[model samples]
Target: MKKSKRKLAAIAAGTVAAPLVAIIPATSAWAHGYVSAPMSRQAQCAAGVVQCGGVKYEPQSVEGPKGQRTCSGGSRFTELNDDSKGWKVTDVGQTMTVTWTFTARHRTTNYEYYVGGRKIADISGNNQQPPQTISHQVNFGGLSGHQKVLAIWNIADTGNAFYACIDVNVK
Candidate 1:
């Protein structure tokens, strides 16, 4: 009788843990988007252009609280914040089209672009879900030389945002 009781408890624990294990991967899937063109750091990781950690698996998952300045959005992908990581820099004109690829679109507040910690452009999201792919024309405003452009997607209904850093050489 005692052995049977122990076996039943173990079975009950496994049953309770099974669903939780199944839900773990689903949480990571909640990540929505990333800059594809001009190939953001995460995009490089996903494309095997750069060797990386877990962010290579989910390039769109570099999400955290809004109003962040770092490339990782204060997430666990600190690798994104490493400027020495040998990120690829794309060459572009003074005015270039930046594109984003979405895995799961969310209602958006606005899209913002920054250079040297200064906001360069702001495109209204109109609080709507964007298409699977969207592009914006951003003028570097005569800013030249190597620059890191920080792109942020603010979700309208959530306090979180997705982040991508695009390294570029303006010529």
Candidate 2:
């Protein structure tokens, strides 16, 4: 009887501890998006483009503060911003298709792409859902050699955004 009771207690503790053991204290309601194509930093972690800790399971959950051009999602995810992440650079032409994979389809305002800290393209999301993947055609006309492009999916109702940095070798 004591062994059974101890097993039950352990099960109960594990059930409670599961939520607390996350790298980020994120609830399902808040995590919304990540760029899948061009393989954003977080997506790279998911795709094994680089070695990342917990982000491999939740690539779409990079919920950092607004106006920051980082892929870390800020704070606990700051390792994503490290310059030596060994991220694989994708090769592309003047235009590339960026696909965003969402876990929770939040109302979205728009999608923006930046290269060398300059806004290159601004596309519309306008609060959509399901269907899983969102794709945008972005032009990298003025960029050459190697560049890191910042892709953002802006949440409509909140001041949050899903940030991704994609390394590319422009052809």
**Pick by lDDT: which candidate is best?**
1
Clashing pairs in 1: none
Ten-residue region with minimum lDDT total, candidate 1? 24-33
Give the per-residue lDDT digits (tens) of candidate 1, residues 125-153: 99999999999999999999999999999
> What residue runs in model 2 are displaced by over 4 Å at the alpha carbon?
1-28
TM-score between model 1 and native: 0.84
Error of 1 at 123 (Å): 0.4
Q: After superposition, how far is residue 50 of candidate 2 from its true place, in Å?
A: 1.6
Q: How does model 2 score by TM-score?
A: 0.79
As a whole number from 0 to 100, the lDDT of residue 5 in candidate 2 is 100
- The prediction achieving the highest TM-score against the true structure is 1
- For model 2, residues 41-119, the per-residue Cα lDDT tens digits are 8887887768888888888778877787876757367768887878888999999999888878877778889998899
